[model samples]
Target: MIVAEVVRSGFVESVHHGIVALTVGKSFGDVDSPFFPRSSNKPLQTVGLLNAGLVPREEADLALMSGSHDGEPFHIERVRAMLAAAGLGPEALRCPADLPLGEAARNAWLRGGGEAEPILMNCSGKHAGMLATCVVNGWPLESYLEVGHPLQKALADAVSRLAGEPIAAFGVDGCGAPIFAISPMGLARAFQRLVEAEPGTPERRVADAMRAHPALVAGTGTEDTVLMTAIPGLLVKKGADGVAAAALPGLGAVALKISDGATRARVPVLLEALRRLGAETPEIPEVVLGGGRPVGEVRAVW
Candidate 1:
């Protein structure tokens, strides 16, 4: 379906085609197409870590472990603490070094003459959690990201179980960790399991921690943070290449992907899907900008 239209000078210039998957009722577009969920699968990976005996000191810590943090000061401090708890440091992380994802933090880092550091990477917390799991299980830390590694295999199993589907393919993520491909329906199923998991279970624990510390899941203006804040008990996560998923416990779940990989098209389609599911969502602008001025708005066509 043409979920979003881009206009310029009162004329439609482009359209975005996408799919929306739901846990119940009818779905739109190609929900069965296999695609990489990217970082959106972090929660399931954290579940694997938990199953491997990784015990974080706080629920917020678990949230951070499942987060693609913005590399703010608080986020960095938490990652450092996680590493410290496992008797490791930034040097132990396998993810490549990168600048902060938050605009303000990036500007500050540049102003202070900061350079790329593994701790500043968005996936640092996940890496820290993986290291902690390795420490707890006495597994080899150096090859933790390798596909044949015990940790990666465990993660694969957890993802398959939660998604209710076997991985169709695997690839390396931007952070060097393994990524798995599943249908949009499978992705929605995983999130449904996450939000609807019984209380006191590891799945529910991760969801609760994320809902409790939404800021840790993403940055201030990020979609996940904004959506979760606006709708209590809602779980939202976005991945690279225009993929996103959300689940309202005991209500409904949605997963989507834009064909052109435009991140801007993601939220509008998601909001529309949620609305169809009878969810109350905050008003979000779908404006397109030109020269820092609003020139158009994206609207869902179906």
Candidate 2:
């Protein structure tokens, strides 16, 4: 579908195309195409950690474990706490060192003469949870990112079960963890199940924590944070490589992938899908800007 179009001075300059999969009381689109879910798979992976006997003192920690956090001070402190509980440190994290994902935090780090650190990586909380899970299960921590590791096997099982489909393929993600490929339908189904899980269950716990602490899940002004704030009870996650997914309890779920890997295109498609599902959404500007001014709009024309 031509999901969005770019115009410059009354001239159509570009178009963004993508596929959207939505499930309310019914399913829509070519949702069975296999694609990598990336960090969208974190919530399910945290379920695996919970199933493997990981129990953090603070429930909010569970949300962080499932987050692609912005690496703000709050996020960093929580990750440090998780590592401390496991008697581990930043050195144990498998994700590569990087500055905070939030611009403000990154600037502050630079201003303070900081260097990239593994704990500051967006996926650090996830790795910390993995290490804690290993500690709880008496498993090896050094090679936890390996596909054949018991931790990975457990996460795969959780993902497959929640997705209601077996993984079609696997690849190494940017953070050095195994990424599973599943259909968009499978991704939506997983998120749907996540929000609908029984109260106090691991799935619901993760969802509740995320919904309650949306900032920890992403950061200020981020898509996930903004969307969650605007729509109550809405669960949203954005993954790398132009992937995004959302689920609202009792309403529906939506998942999309921009074939050309344009991150900006994902939101319009998602909002369109939500509108189709009869859910209320705030107005989202579709205009594209140039030279600090509106040059054109990105409109959905499926």
> CA lDDT, every prediction?
0.89, 0.87
Task: Estimate the TM-score of every prediction.
Answer: 0.97, 0.96
Measured on C-alpha atoms, candidate 2 has an lDDT of: 0.87
Over 1-302, each residue of candidate 2 has an lDDT whose tens digit, in order, gives: 58777677789888887767787644444678788989989998999889889998688998888889988999999999989988988789989999999999899999999999999999999999999999999999999999999999999999999899999998999899999999998898888888999999999999999899899899888888888899889998999977888999988788888778888777777787788877898887767788989987766677
**Shift of residue 124 alpha carbon in model 2, Å:** 0.6
Worst 10 residues of 1 by lDDT: 1-10
Backbone collisions counted per model: 0, 0
lDDT of 2 at 29: 49
> Model 2: clashing residue pairs?
none
lDDT of 1 at 15: 92
Model 1, 134-221: lDDT tens digits are: 9999999999999999999989999999999899999999999999889999999999999899888889999999999999999888
* Least well predicted 10-residue stretch by lDDT in candidate 2: 21-30
In model 1, which residue pairs have backbone atoms overlapping below 3 Å? none
Error of 2 at 55 (Å): 0.5
